[model samples]
Target chain A: MDRKGILLVVSGFSGAGKGTLMKELVSRYDNYALSISATTRSPREGEVDGREYFFRTKEEFEQMIADEALIEHACYVGNYYGTPRAYVEEQLALGRDVILEIEIQGALQIKKRFPDTLLLFVSTPDAETLKNRLIGRGTESLDVVEKRLSRASEEAEGIENYDYFIINDDLDTCVTQVHQIIQGEHSRVSRNLELINTIKKDISKFQKG
Target chain B: MDRKGILLVVSGFSGAGKGTLMKELVSRYDNYALSISATTRSPREGEVDGREYFFRTKEEFEQMIADEALIEHACYVGNYYGTPRAYVEEQLALGRDVILEIEIQGALQIKKRFPDTLLLFVSTPDAETLKNRLIGRGTESLDVVEKRLSRASEEAEGIENYDYFIINDDLDTCVTQVHQIIQGEHSRVSRNLELINTIKKDISKFQKG
Candidate 1:
């Protein structure tokens, strides 16, 4: 069956290696498309429209809100950022799985609007590992690392809401697990309604001589 | 993280090759245990207790019902049969995935009683293929074959309720797909609560100091 694409929402604590995992997944697999959020903030030099983001004026972003075109939108640092529903629907129709990497609030909002969306939570197996990844790999100060760790504690409360968990202990294995999960989602009964309906019709028409 | 086993309910139309697929799976994999149903029917010459079935008296079966020890039970041809909850729970706690090969009604009953059960429906890709297999492989009368086909039509109505469809286009591929799906189910957030909770607790304990 040619199944529809999955709306996958991936959330993770900072320094959990989600960036590396997603990079490997997209580099190795051609079927996934990363989502670009519509933001009211201006794009920096060399950032292309629709590729980096759908840059919108504050007024235009609020208008999208009024028109109910965004899947889930949130404000950060006095700027509006949201997922564009049309782009997501268009990619899904083309049979490309849309990947949305967002924080917990936006992820929950997307789940409320689209109940079948598969939510995945990624994290290092322990907070100690997360802390090492943040400080050991970066030039960030102790204060910044502590701030991110605090935010991680808050995010942990919502991990139960996701449908799957990807612990980034090994990059290749984590990527493989995520890919297998999304692949398996295609076979889910709720997602394969078209195939199921066709088979049911065929069974109904079958007659014995 | 190690996780508990899945209650896998498998059903299919007659001559769908589910029996062959299951045989191949069990022979090739050691992680799965086929469920042994408790039945009031008299055992055949070679059938043994606790292997083929847990032979029980009709009175004992009724007692089990009263004790709420059976997950699901049904009567056929004046004989009572049921899945013993104790056996299933024991095997699952040992981390062995239990397989239940049953018809639509029993499958649905198991799903209702165990909401986390993974329901799988298998079939040949076409009704004509199923018809050919039933006739070519057996000496059953046309009447019997027709009866099975009629039953299949009725069963098709409930196929949509299953979690996945295993199209038996190729035996090895079908077995591999089933294994992959069951393996993938191990990563589901609903199944790994212990790991999720442990991570959540660890994050909470990580202090900003």
Candidate 2:
């Protein structure tokens, strides 16, 4: 059977190495595609449209929402960001597992719409390591870091709702675990009910004959 | 975190290679352990107790059930058969995945009690091959083969309820797919929520400092 692709929703706190893990997953797996989100924010240096984010005008982004073209969208710092349904569907139909690295809110929205979607929440091994990593970044100010930490705690409370969790203690292990989760979900019996029904019919014909 | 092992319920028609797949799984993965079923049926020649089946008397089986020792049990043709709860629990507590090979009815019963258990239904790619294999065995009469085929068809109808459907077209491929399913299920977020919670707390603490 030509099985359809899987929709993977990944959420994690800042400095949890989510980006690194996603890079490793896509690099290692052949049939995985990372979703490109549309955003109203200006692109950073060296970031390409349709690769990093589908840079959109504020009007265009609002229109997308009105048209329901976005699967899940959110407003951040006066800028809109969202996952486009068109690209995700195209990739899924092509049998490529689509990965969506979104926040807990976006993940919840997607899950509500697509209950079958796999939700993975990644985090550090412990609080000490998380604090160390945030400080190590050297980019965020102490105040900003504290705010992020508080937000992270709130996000952590939502972990119970996720389907799987990956510890960012070791990048390789986390990637491996993530890969296994994807593979396992693909084999979930609920997804293959059609094939099973077909086999039953075929077997019945043989029995009668 | 040392997560608990998975409770795997594998069921299929005869000649679907369930036994072979289980053997290969346990041999290849140290984390997996096959649950030895206890049966009141007399052992065949060369069958070893605790390996092939935990041979027990009818009274002994009844006593075990009265004591709530079995995970799942049933009476078949005046013979009692069941899975021992203690052994399965011990192995699972040790973080070893335990697989139980039973019929669809028994599997459903187990699923009712343990909704988290992964149920796998195996079948051949097509009917003709199944027939050929049945006849190839040369141990059963043509009538008996037809009976088995009919029963297999009925069993196949229940495949929809299972968590996975594996086509036993090739031994190696089927075994590998089953292995992948096991690995994937372990990655399920539902099973790792505790670990994720711990990680989230850690990250929050790190970010605060």
Candidate 3:
């Protein structure tokens, strides 16, 4: 039926492996597309524009915010990061389920803008695993890790607001569960109005003939 | 997590293959139990109580009704039929999803009683297919087939009220989709409050320690 794709807003704790899950989800499923974000932060190393992110000048990012071109935007670590409305809309129009992996603020903003948007909170089964993952990465300083853990505590309050809680205890299982949740939503009576209307009309014909 | 089971109210047109789908679903999955209905109608040959249907006397049925024992009840074809509240409650308490396959009137009544109940309406792809399925059974007369198609038209109006519209065009696929929908519901934030609270408390400990 060439149905329009779902607007999925995924948020999680900083060390919850949400990014890895999103990467594997898209890589495994041909029907999904990971949304690209626009950021004023300079691209690191080989991260290319429109791939890792749409690297924009601070002026450009501010203009997008002013023009309301971003679905949700926030300033983090002295740089403005936002989801590009155009790319997401185009991919959704093409019937590709777009996944926006952002924080709770942006996730809630997207939900407010698009009520049909599916809000998913990704996390580990417990905070111990989350903290361990952060420390195990061995890339960030202890202070940075501690700050992220603190942020996670605050984020926990918003987890209840999401539609689904995806515990990334196992990568493959979490991705499959996320995929199923999206697929199941497509059958929701509210989203399938066109099919419902078609069936209604189809049944009316039977009554007449 | 000792999560409580969902009260799943399933309804569909007369020939929607809901019964077969429910059978396959339970057979294929271990988590579901089809609710047995109490009836004053004489048990058909080989039908046993507590199996096919719970055979009851009209006096017993009326007394149960007076006691408000049935979740919902109605008279059909000169016989009384009802869903027993005690059995459904027991199954749900055991963490087994209870499926009540009834018509629009009963389904709506169950919804009103249990606001958290998940309502699923099953149907074929179109009215023509519905009619074909009814006729293809090679049991019902032309008169009965015509009557069912008419009833289906009226039921289509209530399809919108359901939470999900399950198109049973293919038996195996429909069963799988239904299973997925129910499984997905287990991860819904509202359904997993214990997990949410656990995660919340777990993360708070990280902040303090």
Q: Ten-residue segment with the worst summed lDDT in candidate 3 chain A? A: A200-209
Ranking by DockQ: 3, 2, 1
Candidate 2 stretches greater than 4 Å from native? A42-49, A56-60, A66-68, A206-209, B40-48, B55-68, B76-79, B196-209
Segments in model 3 whose C-alpha atoms lie over 4 Å from true places: A41-51, A55-57, A66-69, A205-209, B41-49, B206-209
Between prediction 1 and prediction 3, the one with superior lDDT is 3
Prediction 2 global C-alpha lDDT = 0.83
User: Model 3, A95-179: lDDT tens per residue?
Assistant: 9899998888888888988999999988888888988999998777798788888888988988888999878888888888888
Candidate 2: residue A165 Cα off by (Å): 1.7
Interface RMSD of 1: 1.9
DockQ head-to-head 2 vs 3, winner: 3
Q: Residue A184 of candidate 1: its Cα lDDT?
A: 73
TM-score of each: 0.81, 0.89, 0.90
lDDT of 3 by residue, B98-144 (tens): 89888888888888988889999998888888988899976767887
Per-residue CA lDDT of model 2 for B1-209, tens digit only, reads: 43688899999887777888899888877888899899998876777998889999988999999999998898654578899998888998888889999887779989999988999988878888888888887766788787778878878878878888888888887777788788777766677766665565565553333
**Tens digit per residue, CA lDDT, model 1, B106-164:** 88888887899999999888788888998986656688777778778788888878998
- Report how far off residue B112 is in candidate 2 (Å): 2.8
